[model samples]
Target: MLGMPVTSFGWSVNLIVYLIEEFNIKSIAAAQITNIVNGCLSMLPVVAAILANSFFGNTPVISVSALISLLGIVLLTLISFFDNLRPRPCETGSILCNSPSKLQFGILCAALALVTTGSAGTRVTLASAGANQYEKRKDQGSFFNWYVLTVNIGAIISATAIVYTQDNVSWKLGFGLCAAANLISAIVFISGKRFYKHEKPMGSPFTSLLCVLVASMVKRKAVISSKEEDYHNRGIGKEAKPSVSMPSKSFRFLNRAALKTEGDKKPDVDSIKNIWSLCSVQEVEDCKSVLQLLPLSLAIIFVTTPIVTQSSFMVLQALVTDRGLGPHFKVPAASVQVISIISSCIFIIMNNWIVYPLYHKLTHKPLTPLQKVGIGHVFIVVSMAVSAVVEAKRLRTVENEDHMSVLWLFLPLVVVGIGEAFQSPANTDFFYGEFPESLRNTATSLISLVFGISFYLSTALIDLIQRTTKWLPDDINHGRVDNVYWVLVIVGVLNFGYFLACSWLYRYRNLQGDNEQDPKDIIT
Candidate 1:
């Protein structure tokens, strides 16, 4: 999983620069392409996870995705190598350059689409697969922490080393390296097949969920029974009789699906007749779990959208700022974002070893995932405020001088990195533990969905801000970019309130009591 990111990020991190410099695209157009690619990569994980959970399973999905990614990288390498594949370079100071031909543009989009789709497959499902390798919940939590750490490490290396190679060396050579890395990742992952604890694909849960919704709505007039005996059990083979004493009070309308009507079938091994009148208690519960989680997931989207917008804005800020690290060494504007990645890597380790352990020692109990997420929210708010302050200072300084030093942006990046350390792992652990057992892979994939939505939302926010206010003018020197960060601060605070309410109402389905028990040793 880590290896594939290195391969993918190599090209993806420097994509905006590649489009602007090599393809002769405008800055705004290049940024838009970056946003689209980022959104697709983040969003497609849910689709990939569903496929993994319902049909193919994680290892096959990840291996196949890696192969597809390699093909995309190979295509990208071809574009880099063949001058004919790109638009002609413009004269030194020309206001406009030749646009890419339709053929070139089509090929580029196809390559990007393939890479983004393949990336989505590996990103979330791999985390679920890793969690599956361990039986203990604590072990699973540890794996998730390391999972985030590896992601940050991969991102940092790609954002810095791979980006530098692309910018300074040959673009073909850089893309060639990405292809090689992806090939190696595929080989390494496949080689571990015999040792891996592969989860078999369960038939689509979405179908069952949809059935529950349809059945509940269709039989809304039916009287809901509180008796355990009234609900269909279908106690067959591994599916034991449900121990849920009664249906949950929340989403009371959905309880009607499990309510036995006159025509409702008993716990038969054969089949269920009326889809609208009959559903297993377990099925109804699974649907309820999703409904319960939806609000929490939706609330985080607002928090993340601002972060995504800030990331892109930060890169632009770096470009205009003085990026010199020393007398000779100058930081690439793209690479400056690695500050956040590096901080995330460092803080994830600290969060797992120091913060979590310290809290446990002090309280005689481990911090809950919701608590961790709340702490992350606080850090995110602080990060936004810092960003606003820094941007305001930068704006003031740049008015009198050529540029402000990029080093000033590090505080906000580091702050947000710390926030991510708390929130990201917490969100993953929460979803992985709280979601229905059958949908664990899909649960983990929700994190990616949050990010994906945030990226798309960020693009929309940017457009809206540009249209409404003078905060995001074409040039930063003329705009109050600080005001944009202030707006995000307000949004973060409001979203945090929504998160608190949802978190208070939610009951953990898998994390607390159920997961704390010790499992019997596997006979390996």
Candidate 2:
């Protein structure tokens, strides 16, 4: 996972600069393109997760995806190497620079699509795979913490070292290095194939979920019986038994699917029963589990929106800021985002080594996933508030000077990073733990879904801001960019409230059996 990000972030983190410099794209257009690509990168993971769960399993999916990523980066490296593959560099203050040719643009888009798809495919599946290696839920949770830490470490390197290389050194060399890293990752993953505990694909679990929904709809008029024997037991062994005594009372309408109807078989023999009129108890419960998780997942999208927006725009902000370290050294505009990555890495370690242990020691219990997610939501709100203040300060300082120091951007990013450290792993842990075991891969991919949706929403939000007001003009310095941060602060607060409500109402299903920690021990 770490090695894969070296290439993934290498290309993505500094993409705005690449578009501006190599493709001669405008800043706003570049930002919009980045958002769209980022959105696709995030959203595609769901498809990848499904593929992993239904057909190829985790290890194979990750290996193939990593290989595809390498090919994509190699294409990108070639693009950097050949001047004809991209437009000529735009002169400073030149608005009339040549756009990329159709072929150049097509190849660029294809490469990006491939890389994004590959990266997204591996990102979450690897988490599922890693967690699957451990039987204990606590060990799985620890693995998730370290998984995030490793990701941030890779991101730090990409945002700083790879970004710096792309900026100062030859773009070809930088992208070549990314391609090499991706190759190494693929090789390493392939080499470890023997050691991996492979989970066999159970055909398509989604089919059963859809079947349950369809069966419930078909049996809508049927009365739900309280008897345990009313539910169908389709298969032999443990799967045929009820995961719970009854379908959840929350979504009572869905209970009709499991109702023993006239045509339904007592022993569920090979006899023909209308497929849409009958479902096993487990199928109904699986659908309910997903239904329960959907709200929390949707709420998380808003929490991530501001952070995604911050990272994207922070690059543009750094471009106009005083990025100099000394007379001889200069910070790359994209490299400024590394502060958040580094901070996240630090906080992940602290949370694992200090925070969790200390909480356990004091309360005789560990922090629950929802508690961590709530804490994360709080930090994001605080981060947005800090961002608003810092942007206001930067604007004030910009009034007197051409640019303020880029270092000022670090505070809000660090706050956001710490918040992510709390929330991100916990979010994954919560979903993975609470979701039906059959949908484990999908559960792990939920974070990516949040990111994907949030980025697209952020793009729309930015477009809305630009269209409605002058807060985000082509040249942000002339507009009230601080107001943008303020808007995010408001959104963040409201979203945090929404998250609290969702977390409060949510009931854990599978987590109780895995972790010995009491549900009442949650900090929030």
Candidate 3:
């Protein structure tokens, strides 16, 4: 939780600056590279989660991942400490600047690959592993909430301390600090091995979904027979409609999971829990809920795209805008993004203690996770609109031959941080609470997957804007960035409608037997 994100985000927070300044990469190319790197980082967790659930257990994967991460960080530090490991320093905007040689690029790519693989292994796996230590869903939810908080705290430290060091002191010292953190955290994790709960590995939840589909197809005729008998008998038949129960009736065909068989064993200590056989109602509901969660997840991806895109642009804005704080100090542009992290932390605490509690007190009910996500949608729209306004003002300042204060960028980013506090933890709670025990590991990885998709999509969107429109020139000041923000504002509006439709139709799954059910028949 603590060490892994610190290492990854240490590079992530200032990666564009590092690429642009150190390797002489173009500004837009640097941003695309950063997004691509992060997208891959965000994605590898799903693979790691599948491995943890289906094959190698969490401990071995995490243990190996930590060592790999340590090595990658060490390599990156070497690149920073030794000038010969990277391209020599180049003049700003010089046409004669040398590009990195193939060997230098290869070494950088290898180090990054190791880091991404290692970091992905630990992230969501550790969340599930920690949550597994708890039997109660409430306790599990609390653990995951704190898991997210811990990650954000690591990001905050990375963006503030590590970024400041990278910008103001030396990249060598900064990257060395990241390597040290990775090593220390790995030692701490390994030392606590004996105390950790080692759950029996369940087969992948994804396979469970497939089995559900197969089961339904095999029993597709059963549903037809039941309906026919009830119709012919005029409601007096023994099979009379099968009177749907715990799993609900929306996908009644899928309820084939609980269908009785001639050779079925009693719901007992053994046989009935077999993964390859008929399943219980609880397992049936689990698969259905996962299906139900799909649209909401897709809605989230689209709603969040604009915000993710703006986040990259904000760093670029800070770079060009005035960062001077006083006669002697200037704020590091990378550190400017930390405003979102700080505000997210503050709002997380506030929602836990203040906002949510106050709402519950006044309304006599707790705010739902869906509502929290909706609030995030509204705030991000406002943030984009605010960014557009701010950018327009900045462009005017540029036109008038003055540098706009970087402080002008603060308000929208703070709003973005506030929106994150609403969206992300609630997202975690929603999936963790609603998803069945068998799929918990996969559930925890959902947010990471969403980021993976959005980062990739956002990069593509940025490229399209750069190519088809005149909005994203190398010199952002000379481009129509405000227009880009406006386009994002429109995107936010359209996605909110889709989100609302999904929310309006979505049903909360029953959680009564979630923790107790054997997940043998489960799929993620």
Candidate 4:
């Protein structure tokens, strides 16, 4: 966990600087490219998880991905080593710059592709793999909290040490360290092979979902039936009676998918024969579970979009702001996120060790995942508001020909970290607990999935803002970045309300059975 993020962030956290200085790319263009890379890093985990849960098991997929990461980072190291691999340096403050050749650009793209793939794959699979080692819910929950801590710790090292080295030392040395970290992570994962409790591939639950949709549409006119014997149990063996969950009454139209007509007369014993026409009762319920999560998921997209957008923009804000720390050390612009990481780390530790335990004892009720997530929402709104206020102050300072300390960026970023502390692990626990066991790896990757969509949307939002308003430009000194933050403040506030509606309407699923309707609305 530690080595992977260290290596991943070691290169990526400083990517904007690398592109602008080394590749001679424009600043705004560089930020977009970085967003695209981060988007890929967020997106690919779903694919990896689907593969892990459907085809190959976790270990095999992860083992191969780690090697891919090592290979990719090594390739990046080589690019840094060879002058021919990059373009000539652009003159400082000059509009015109040397554009990278096709060869240089291609190698860089290939390297990033590999690194993003490796990083995303390793993160999701390793998370699922770690949690799988523990059978008890408490143990799994603890594993998740610690998993987040380790990832943040790794990021802290990359954001601080690696970023500082890249800024003051050399890119070659910084990238070399990243490659070495990847190698060490691979070695450690391989060495721990015998201890893991491996789960076999469950085949694609998504396929079953598809089958449910198609079968229901095909039989949309069929009369709904409540008979337990009428619904197919294809998930069970032909002889064994699978008496678990009958077709659910909610989304009663979908119940047609499991209801048997002439297609059930002599159902082939070999397989779910022509599963498009008939599905198991379990499959119907699984489809409903995913549907039930839609509103909550959509609400979080707003939550995630603002946070990610703010994060990307903060780097740009750092570039324009005075970054001095002590007399000797000026913090790297890319390292600005370290504040957020540290804040998150602190909150996660306190939440796990002190806050949660203390709250449970005092209130006689443990904190539910929904409550934790709500707390995160409150913090995110505050963070965005603070961000806009700080940016406005910085702009005024810059306009007056006075300097604003980089420390001013600290408040919003710190709130961001605290929000992450609550929302991230809480979301992990919620999805992992609620999603069907067959989709365990996929459940773990849903947070990554949210990030993926959020980053892509944020990229679009940035593009839209750049095109329509004089908010983000090649030189932020001339742009109204505070306006951009103001827009996000609106987004965060609106989304917080959306999330509240979703939480109030949502009822916690009874995971124990597919049929039982024990609805527990968001825990007060």
Q: Which is the leading candidate under TM-score? A: 2
- Stretches of model 4 off by over 4 angstroms after superposition: 236-243, 267-269, 272-274, 510-519
Best-to-worst ranking by TM-score: 2, 4, 1, 3
User: In model 1, which range of ten residues has the least summed lDDT?
Assistant: 515-524
Sort the candidates on lDDT, descending order: 4, 2, 1, 3
Which has the better lDDT: candidate 1, or candidate 4? 4
Decoy 2 TM-score against native: 0.96
**Candidate-wise lDDT, in order:** 0.83, 0.85, 0.80, 0.86
Worst 10 residues of 3 by lDDT: 227-236
Clashing pairs in 4: none
What's the C-alpha lDDT at position 401 in model 1? 81
Candidate 2 per-residue C-alpha lDDT over 60-163 given as tens digits, one digit per residue, 9 for 90 to 100: 89988998888788889999888889988767886778999999999999999889988888889989999999988888888998888888888889988888
Clashing pairs in 2: none
RMSD of 4: 2.5
Give the backbone clash total of model 1: 0
111-220, model 1: which lDDT tens digit per residue? 88888888788999889999999987778888999988888888888898888788777889888888888898899999999999998898787988988998898789
- As a TM-score, model 3 comes out at 0.89
